[model samples]
Target: MQELHDAPLAPLTTFRLGGPATRLVTATTDAEVVEAVRAADESGTPLLVIGGGSNLVIGDRGFEGTALRIATTGFHLDGTRLELAAGENWSDAVARSVEAGLAGIECLAGIPGSAGATPIQNVGAYGQEVCDTITEVVAYDRTTGETVTLTAAECAFRYRNSTFKDQPDRYVVLRVRFALEDAGGLSAPIKYPETARALGVEAGDRVPAARARETVLRLRAGKGMVLDPADHDTWSAGSFFHNPILSDEAYAAFLARVRDRLGAGTAPPAYPAGEGRTKTSAAWLIDKAGFTKGYGTGPARISTKHTLALTNRGQATTEDLLALAREVVAGVHAAFGVTLVNEPVTVGVSI
Candidate 1:
């Protein structure tokens, strides 16, 4: 374990907009992670678990507790079953699965963060969610003070949320196990229309796993979703807002509002989320609300390449980013009745 006092946290996150942590502990093994957590709990200190730092937004005030960075590494593959330590890089793990001819997670390529963090957010991209392949999550149950293994069903996986997320302080994920498909080196059936169009194949068609992974990476890069230090647009927490899933009544009202704002012929992106629920694109809402690409004059602005991402243009404070986000949210709500919700987890701040 490596420990530092009053460590700057901005450099750890993709947005690069936070103050310092009172104490930072980098744990390279599951044992160390558990030990660190126990120590913090015993001392009654608040604990913050950090992984790849892709989906985090720490405030300028920073965390007054111990920020534990999970850096453990382990990737064990037994036939089609895979087990990864909490600290394994997510995007790299996807590539490795593709190289090994696994078919389940190819569509999640280029997503940032650690493998352990995937279950917390039920991370998904291009129609594939971690819950689709994840069989179990091994975590330290802080409440019980024992390590426990929870099955997929027990995780209560939902759209971009899970049991771990709902009860953030209850469990410390140590490892994740997945059951991937061995589809003869072919990718899983393409589900997202955008990905299918990019691959020049019809939806439901199966291509080479590597080809699917590469195609998704290319698409992500084009939208500034992939990490590129040279590109300021990539300095963002992927999508700034979650696609709002509204009830039938809410959707009807939203549609009426959309027609009122953008003419009766205008149709915003809508997809069936579940029974009587519909999911609409947050990107479309933001764009239609007049916050187009590169939508701010301050250090924080929407990505020039994508409407969904809010980027930090080289120099930005947490307040600057939040201000831009609030503006986008209020603008979208004024244009349409639907309110936008942030996708990234905020630390010591509310948006």
Candidate 2:
């Protein structure tokens, strides 16, 4: 275990805009992780867990408590069953799965984060979500002070949210387990129309896992979802806003609003989110609301490659980033009557 006091946290996040923690503990093993958490809990100190820091927005004021960084490493594959420790880099794991001829996670390639954080958000992309393949999650239950395994269903996944996210402080994910498919070296059937179009295949057609992974990585890179420290566009928490899933009634009203604002011929991107729910595109909303790509004139701005991503173009403070976020949210809501919710978790701040 490595420990530091008054540690700067900006470098830990993709946004690169946070302040510092009162103390920072980097745990290299599950035992170290548990020990750090237990000590903090017993001492009645507030605790913040840091995984990949891909989907976080810390306040400028800094955290007044302990920040434990899970750095444990383990990646074991037994046939199609895979287990990843809390610290294993997610994108690398996806690449390994594709190299191993696995199909389930191919579409999720290029998503940046730790494997343990995957279950927390039920991370999804290009039509494949972690929930689709996750069989179970092993976490250290902070409430009971014991490690426990929770089945996928018990995780209560619902589009970018899960029990871990709902009860953020109650569980420290130790490992994530997934059951992938061999698929004879072919990828799972293509589900996203954009991906299918890009691959020149019809939806439901399968391509080589490597090809699928590569294509998704390319697509993500185009949208600034892939991490690249040199690119200001990539300096973001991937997509900053979650696609709003509205009830049928709300969708109808929103559709009317779109038509009224953009003319009768105009339409917003929509998809069935579940029974009586419709998921609309956050990118579309932001664009139609007149916040084009590369929007903003400050250290923090909309990504040049993607409007859905609010970025730090270097020298940005958390407040600057949040200021841009609030502007986008308010502008989109005013234009479309749909409020945009941030996809990343915020600490000591609300948007």
Candidate 3:
């Protein structure tokens, strides 16, 4: 375990906008992770867990407690079953699975963050979610003070959320186990239309796993979703807002508002989320609301390549980012009745 006092956390996150942490602890093993958490809990100090820091938004005021960075390394692959330590890089894991001819997570390529973090938000992109292949999550239950394994069903995975995310302070993820498909080096049936079009295949067609992964990476790079240090556009917690899911009545009203404002022919991207619920694209809403790509004049602005992302243009503070996010959210809500919710987990701040 490596410990530091008053450590700067801006460099740890993709946004590079946060202030320092009162104390920072980097744990390189599962045991160290547990130990660090236990010590903080025992001392009654507020505990902040960090992984790849890709989906985090820490305020300029900083955290008043210990910020524990999970850095453990373990990638165990046996046959089609894979177990990864909490700290394993997520995008690299997807690439490795593709290299090994696994079929499940190819479409999730280019997503940043740690493997442990995937289960928390039920992280999904293109068409694949971790919940689709995740068999179990091994976590230290802070409430019980014991390590326990939770099955996939027990994780209660939902769109962009899970049990761990709902009960953020109750568990510390240690390892994640996945059951990948051995599809003769072919990818899973493509589900996202954009991905399918890019691959020159129908929606249900399967391409080579490597090809699927590479194509997704290319698509992400084009949208500035892939990490690029020199490019300020990639300095964002990919997709700042979750696509709003609306009830039948809410969807009806939203559609009416859309047609009223943009024109009767204008149609916002809508997909069936569940029974009587519909999910609409956040990007479409922001763009139609007049917050187009590269929307801000300040240091914090929307990505030039993607309307969904709100980025730090090399010289932004957490407050600057939040201010821009609030403006976008308010603008979207005023234009349409739907409210936009942030996707990233905010520390010591509210959007």
Q: Write the per-residue lDDT of candidate 3 for residues 204-309, one digit (tens) a residue.
A: 9999999999999999999999999999999999999999999999999999999999899988999999999999999999999999999899999999999999
Per-residue C-alpha lDDT of model 2 across residues 21-59, encoded as one tens digit per residue = 999999999999999999999999999999999999999
What is the Cα root-mean-square deviation between model 1 and the actual structure?
A: 0.6
Task: Point out where model 1 deviates above 4 Å.
Answer: none
Stretch of 10 with least lDDT, candidate 1:
259-268
Off by over 4 Å in 2: none
Model 1 per-residue lDDT tens digits across residues 159-254: 999999899999999999999999999999999999999999999999999999999999999999999999999999999899999999999999
Per-candidate TM equals 0.99, 0.99, 0.99
Q: Write down the lDDT that model 2 would get.
A: 0.93
- Can you list the residue pairs that collide in candidate 1? none
Weakest ten-residue segment in model 3 by summed lDDT: 10-19
